[model samples]
Target: MINFKIRYTLLLFAACISLQACKKAWQDHTAITIEALNKTLIQQINETPDLSTFSTYLVKTGYDKVLASSKSYTVWAPTNTAMQTIDAAILADTAKLRLFVANHISYQEYFTTAPNPSLVIRTLSGKNIIFTPATFEEAKIVKGNVYVKNGVLHTIDQASGTKQNAYEFMMSTGLSTKQRGFIQSLFHTEIDTSKGVKLYTDPITKKTIYQAGTTFPVTKNTYFQRVSDISSEDSLLTYIILSDVAYDAEKAKIGRYYNLSTSATKTDTLTQFAVVKDLVVNHVYTIDNLPDTLTTVSGVKIHLDRSAIIQTQKLSNGIAYVVSSIGYQILQNKIPVIYIQGELPDSVRVPSTLSIRTKKDLNDVKYTDMQSRSITSSPDPLYYYRYKTTVNSAQYKVYWRAVNDIFTTSFNQKVDFSATRYYPKAVETPLATMGYKAVAVSDYSEVYLGLYTPANYGTLYTFLVSATGVVSTAPSALSLDYIKLVPVN
Candidate 1:
């Protein structure tokens, strides 16, 4: 979150749009303009037979009386058809019922006669309501002659900001058409896989499926980026795209028992060391790894961090190690992934003169592979470049090759970045400032709390160079984002 109050402004603006839509009007008989929606009240909302289940929810939540009050509201009234479409069982549940419908209301005064075609309104629920593709005619008279009523109502097709993240658990093996509980609060949805991209269908809106390989439209706070399966033929990598939020899996108390090869029991917590390392090590262990189908389980997912176990040099009977950083920190054999989302209009031709700076006192300089792909007009923002530098006395090798989004896989000392485009308007002219930045850490492993060390001190910097992608040997000082000292215990 930007920690800025930008949204507060939008909320107020939306309310103004909705409230102003249906102006109050006085019939030739009544002198004062009054809200028209008062005429078409929510007369009777029957939860019994289900003409509109949401109306029943409004009644149950005590909002029915609230609506009857003088306070005006803009309700995204779902038709009886939409209401009946909800599962009968779900409609019967009082809890799910409240959230489903109560979340739809806005308190901005809208009259039944408001003629405005398109206006954004604020919900009593404080959600912004944008009514588009609409019109205004005899509804709320414009300007003078009418000072407008307290409220008006305008029908709208869609309500904005619906729970896009609501996971419906659409389709999975053995999962019944009958709704099981939603994958209780899905954490991160994507995962890195040895078996290409993986996908899962949302349970509710069954049609929407999330596939890996590329960015999926972010839904809700829990964006379904990728799904990695340890219960598969290939289980070394854990797939991750963009997680909707920093998932708190600990309290969720989710996930199933481990599915080791030689186990019959479902919840076994201990296994031999060899089995531990083989089954799980570098892969990202998560809470949602449980499958709907039953599976044999052996050994628990170990967390050997300070929070979990006392630190010592002794090799664990189990191989799991927990670090502060989330997900897979270091993959012995990295899968270098890069995707060129969108590139600049002009072709980027790197100036022939290029220089590589191997930071001193740093062992390994890890730049996966050079990618000339499109993301933003800029190339750096398009790809994530990690340099897993070692402490000292280590050789670094890098080669240029065309790569997909995964870039950590192969390295040949000789490289060809020609296919890769330079970000921020590829420098063609002999340049001075490129604003390229890098974190020259001693070791990425040292960034974690206890694993860090004084030797891990590194610099984050931008380099000045020629039109070609090389650090200018002669002209300029290196600019740094900030240099920090990280200490390892």
Candidate 2:
């Protein structure tokens, strides 16, 4: 009887302990199972009755694939109430619907960490969308920080496209749309494939290597193609476009120079073509922000009329500034003028037979009698040729053609230039003197005018050549052809 009682008591105690252990196990298992059942972005949308419309649109548009992916993303989900304002026509169109959904979805998580509170995010639709936490807070984060297998999801009261990139905004307005040529010039690239083998010389080895013939197929560059494909995230560009009024006025200047017909293509070298090209190229800058002044690819200065800016747009890789005017008149025979001896205008032509005679003025200042000659005679004599350049920097390299006298002895003369100086001091000083050995008429000398720096603030800078020496002396017969001024950085 005692044994039976002891066995029964032990069995009862064992049963109670096992029941307690099973209860604890059940609690742990239930907790883990609950965690596994947590909602994903797709599930959350479907489960929430308020989000039914958004979920249905996602299904209808097939954006569920993005949500189903394991890759991380942050979705700025708009509630059914907020989405009610969206046009049904937009949702019905697959293309529009896809882009609309993509605009709301960001590829990276933003609620916990972002580069900025108002971060600029690129969506799958190839457009930039602004995601501002503060702005979202104004409407309230209806559902905040719901983590799923892929990423965290947030429901916002409202969200829409707030900003357009450089390209997008340029397309948004009719006025800016006409300025497409300017935008196109900023991001243009040419790909040329020749029909023959390329002979490349190795600079280090000084050996020649010939590649196999690439001539089987030739590829040419098309301007229209470049204009169509203008946006690149790799290279940042800033563009300044003339407003419609400004562009039309500038085009009128071109029409005055060249006859414009509708048949003329963009590539046509009409008088307005080069001017427009320079104007467009002058607007492109390799930087992101618009400074007071910027240098173009052609090394021309573009002054920003801040007060006259008609429109401004920011893009993934650059910014665009639209202004009423470039703050300067478009002039011809501008910087980088190349004058050939064979092509001289009668106004600036110096005759070969004229021998210059030096005479003293009342002040004992030596002057030359150039009454019959086209050249101006003075201590600082002026050449018949004039090249107007915009001095954006402190120095520019001047290259000129000088003809040597064949029958006379060689004489060294210091050639000085007069230029509108801008920096260090705004005074007209003798541009540094450079030496040129005049060669025989059969041969030409190409020498640099060493120290020609102009300080004219984006205005037309004129470079006048003046030589100091006795013109009547032997070996004094020198012919001047052309002077080219190239801007130095």
Candidate 3:
């Protein structure tokens, strides 16, 4: 059976195709006069009340003169109904309305449809718009494509102040009282950065807001209670989305948002799984317009343990500004290092080789602390697991690919990994062939890398052979993690 969202997807796809044709025609033809097109559009608007905002928006945004000239484009015009919902005064103002209509105008006619998320679109004002279709593509596409005489318009549900896809609704209104109430109800303290995502008993109430194996701290509010609180008794607990696992083959890695959550339609591509599980415990949600209770704002680099963000700025609601004589400036570079472990293990033995999964788990197995995040832990959290050995069947093989090509042939320097030993990580490295080990890696697990990941995350030289492998020569792709646990029988 077709999903309900598919029809919407097809509509968006059709709209895109229409715009794409216009763009191609504009680029291929000579001086396609905008005056003729605008005349037709104005007539159409006269007959259609819904197009009034489109007409008014054109005039207010200073497009009358330009559209009356020679700019061939197609715009996905919003109906009068859509415009009626928007404030007329806001729509009537030239400068103010630009923000609302910014998504409507692309620079050229060629960009008739949304490309894959990576495709770049230059707006009429020369700004760039990225089409992100990670989730709800049909909804997003429907919201995005609107065609007009001179250009196409994509009508988003909300005015995302910062061009982010994560929080469209949240961006529409800044820091709602309900959101604030939610945060305050959990804990008054700022996020414990030492833990990427945190949860625990309320120090005051001891209500067990947090439970074992949660991601970010879940709230007692409406949103969380529905998804997480299966039993009514499960209510009142705050769950967190934790990205705490070491280079989890399934999760991608311990620290990052990219490639973790995806919506792919291909048969083999996985979809609908919670990239972020249990909202409150183990994850750090990216919040914009932090509440007024948060004072003396200072920016610090935050690592997202496990997060699913629309990553867009909602209307900057209720976000007060204070003038301190300092502006944002970029300076020194730093990277986060984690020493993964829990409590010390009592029994210990040395081995010849370590599996890859244990190493990744060790890297991810740290608890949030007071001083800093998982750099290392008490009695050193690093000394829990040791490297044993690679599978005896493991083969050292040369995987080659095209580095460059002059024609159909003739390329220089195919990517190679000869000197590097691809060892299974038992723990985060400073690895020793002999002597004592720092971290005790959990066994029967595995780590895998992507096409790209920041350095110092795991072993740079040796990558573990995982249950899954992509055909990439990048460091992240080769990096793998492994651990051992029981199977359901």
Over 4 Å off, model 3: 1-49, 87-89, 92-94, 110-120, 125-303, 306-489
- Residue 443 lDDT in candidate 1: 27
Identify the leading candidate in terms of TM-score.
2
For candidate 2, list the clashing residue pairs, or say none.
195-215, 404-438, 404-439, 422-455
The number of clashing residue pairs in each candidate reads 59, 4, 96
TM-scores for all candidates: the values are 0.27, 0.49, 0.27
Looking at model 2, report the run of 10 residues with the lowest lDDT sum. 369-378
Question: How does residue 47 of candidate 3 score in lDDT?
Answer: 47
Give the Cα-based TM-score of candidate 2 against the true structure. Answer: 0.49
lDDT values, one for every candidate: 0.30, 0.52, 0.31
Q: In model 1, which regions exceed 4 Å deviation?
A: 1-57, 109-131, 134-150, 155-489
2 or 3, which is superior by lDDT? 2
Q: Which of the two, 1 or 2, has more lDDT?
A: 2
Segments in model 2 whose C-alpha atoms lie over 4 Å from true places? 1-38, 48-50, 132-144, 162-165, 168-172, 176-178, 181-229, 233-238, 252-291, 294-299, 311-322, 328-489
Residue 276 Cα positional deviation in candidate 1, in Å, after optimal superposition: 23
